[model samples]
Target: MTLERITLAGGCFWCLEAVYEHVRGVHRVESGYSNGAHPSPNYEQVCSGTTGHAEVVRLDFDPAVVSLRELLEVFFTIHDPTTLNRQGADVGTQYRSAIYWHTEAQRALAAEVIREANEHHGGRVVTELQPETNYHPAEAYHQHYYARHPDQGYCAFVVASKVDKFLASFKRLVK
Candidate 1:
């Protein structure tokens, strides 16, 4: 099977990771830092907003199961791409909205989706579309955070809401 991947930063990686884990075509979603100047930057460094890294989820998926456009639709729908460097109260460059495309086809599709989403959101989409590098997976404790801590405050309030939105809107895409 031909697998395609994209990196997305929409607020906290935990939120995106939680929602993506439940999607039908997503094979893997790893939380990482990208588009940063520093190499091997840790969570604290990224959170400081000085590393230039965005907390991102790199997803591996099969196009036969779900098209890139469908994934982009979900990405744009679930998060407030209109916000710059913040989602809800989570503020910082690490929380920026960004799409890191892996291929030209992906890049083109992402731009198209962003334009459409911007139109729908009244032309205020602040989501950045860029070629990302310097990816470093978050510490193991961060992996599957929502699943492991469903009752936790952040997960219950923020992440679960996003997941509910995804599940409600994209019923056919749920696995």
Candidate 2:
């Protein structure tokens, strides 16, 4: 069972984290900041968009159970790849859609996914595919936020919609 890791940012890490947690082969999802200037940036600093970082969820998964292509499909479905530097109400560089690929293979797969998505939607895919960079885990409170606070306003209104979409669209892929 070989495990691989990929870092992605589509909006608030909480939303992405919540969706991936239910993915069949996902081992773990850690909310973090990546491609930033700071060695170890705090959430506040990264939120300011000065760190050049995006709020990403570092996903550890089994390739046999869930291929990178499948993962990217879920990712593209849950987030708006056409939007630049924003996801819904969250607007900033930190919320930009991006894929921080860990290897050449992942890079190629990400590019293929983006190309396919763009072709399917008939619009430009704004999602950035870049090499993996330094990742700073967000504050402990931010981890599993939706699970721990499902009734919270943001989770209820925003994250829940994505979760529902994931569950509905990927019923066969769910564990």
Q: Say which candidate scores most in lDDT.
A: 2
Displacement of residue 11 (Cα, Å) in model 2 is 0.4
Q: What local lDDT score does residue 161 receive in model 2, on the 0 to 100 scale? A: 98
Please report the TM-score between candidate 1 and the true structure: 0.98
The Cα error of candidate 2 at residue 9, in Å, is 0.6
Go through the candidates in order and give each one's C-alpha lDDT: 0.93, 0.95
What digit string (tens of lDDT, one per residue) describes model 2 on residues 145-165? Answer: 999999999999999999999
Root-mean-square deviation of Cα positions for candidate 1 versus the true structure, in angstroms: 0.7
TM-score of each: 0.98, 0.98
* Tens digits of lDDT, candidate 1, 1-175: 8899999999999999999999888999999999999999999999998999999999999999988888888988889999999999999999999999889888998999999999999999999999878899999999999999999999999999999999999999999
Question: In angstroms, how far off is 127's CA in candidate 2?
Answer: 0.4
Model 2 lowest lDDT segment of ten: 120-129
